[model samples]
Target: MPRPRYLLALAGLLFAGLAAALASAPRDAGSQVFSPRAVVPMVARDEGAPPPPPATPTPFAPTATPTPRPPTATPTAAQPTPTPRPPTATPTPAPSGLRLQGVNWYVNTTGTIYVMGIVVNGLSTPVELVRINVRFYNASGQLLATDTTYADVSIIPAGGSSPFWTLLLNPPPGVASVEAVLGTYSVSSRPPITGLTPTVTNIYRSSSIALRVVGTVRNDSSATYQFTRVIAAYVDSAGYVIRIETDYLEPSTLAPGQQGTFEAIFFNAPAGLETNNLLIWTTASR
Candidate 1:
């Protein structure tokens, strides 16, 4: 059963051609035709034969898988946070013990009864919005009419006093007596006004004419004021208030370090009104 020698030679040539084709082709590791485990056999050699060339080391090395790490924040210097300012609140004050300091009433040319007075803050705390109540009586001690009036000053410090004026334009016939009393008020949280400094520079008063008072008020406070209300009164030599007149400064609003002027006029002047005994006062408001 010996095969033909020519057939054997042809098969050997076919195998040699395939080996040459594989040696000349390009290699793509991603999609190779041959298995990675395949290897060529070394040729047989005698003990005396020279040892085969030392195996060449591969230049390609397996790369290590990177270990993931948590992201680190850059170091930054700490900054201080400013605290917000709290809102200011107006609180109710303790009970205000107010007392009437000076009170006077008069009848003008129009038969209008004018009741004016001063309220003294008897408490140790500041008070605001002081008011006055006036009650009139006839000759028979009957109630004629009544009215309430607010103080010209909006705030009064402890032991300080403010003036109030009320009008009874229509009084019952035979109104003989009147009583001025203290009314409502509030305790204030703000400090008492000490910036309004009223200085009387001129005055005119006579028994036959109306009374006039001129003054200037300086804003000694560091804050601006929207109003500088001025009030004045003519006092007799016996210390009784003859008349009270209220006025506002010409330039009502006053900035810090500025001053304002005012003219107070009281018509139907009464006797014993003295220029030397004028009581001029002022209070600044926001």
Candidate 2:
């Protein structure tokens, strides 16, 4: 019986030791698992902190730029002006026929009188006077009286003529002088004769290389002759008149039995023997 009691005591002691060891091992294993899970959760919280400070937002930059433009043009300056030209002058005309030659004023025994002398140059054609007007003026340059008359007066058929009585005026008061005018008022104008016959003589050549011709003009009519101009024709050895020489006769007057000598010259003449014939014509007053 003693041995059986000793065996039961040993089995009881071993069961108690095994139960205590199993209980302590379970407590240490649960502590190691819980520590590793808490450490992992703490590391995750530290890694995701504040989302990295919101990434620190940067400023926006510009893309592309444009180019600049150029300036505009300016205007120019002005120019100068031009000058004007001058005008031309006119010429005067020559006087016609039937002009007043002279005037005379005198006081007679009857009353204050005026006398005037009239002249008409003879023409190549016959000229007839149809009217004559006489005007009297006083010393104060006032018109005293005017006398108008008409008559059939025949002028010599020649170029130049003498003084002829065509008008006579007698007025009263302070009469200074009388002006007499004679013209072809009612007569028709005659055609001028260009050609005439002349007698030539005494022909020679001068030292100045000019051909001198002297001629005596003969009157073709019974009335007094007045020579105006002389034209000479120069003839060569072939009997052909090649050139002409003209001479204007001023103060030309001729009587019934009187003749005038006319001289003419030619600058150009042939070396052969030559002859000259003259032609005389007239321009007279009516």
Report the C-alpha lDDT of model 2 over 1-286, residue by residue, as the tens digit. 5698789998999999999888777433211211111000111111111111113568887686666666575547665666766767667653333333322223323443323232333223444443455566666657777776543223323343222222233455565444555533322355333223356687787753466777765445444545455655443332222344556543355544445567877554444324333333343221
Best by lDDT: 1
RMSD of 2: 66.7
| TM-scores, one per candidate | 0.63, 0.28
| Model 1: lowest-lDDT 10 consecutive positions | 33-42
Best by TM-score: 1
The lDDT for every candidate, in the order shown, is 0.69, 0.43
lDDT score, candidate 1, position 14: 100
C-alpha lDDT of residue 157 in model 2 = 33
Candidate 1 structure quality by residue, lDDT tens digits, 1-286 = 5579989998999999999999999864322211111111112212111113336998986689788897698558877989999989989764446766446566666777666666667678888877666677765667778788877777888978787777888777766666666656777889877877888887776446567778889998888888677888765554445578888897999998998999888777654354436777778777
Shift of residue 232 alpha carbon in model 2, Å? 0.7
Residue 204 shift from truth in candidate 2, angstroms: 1.0
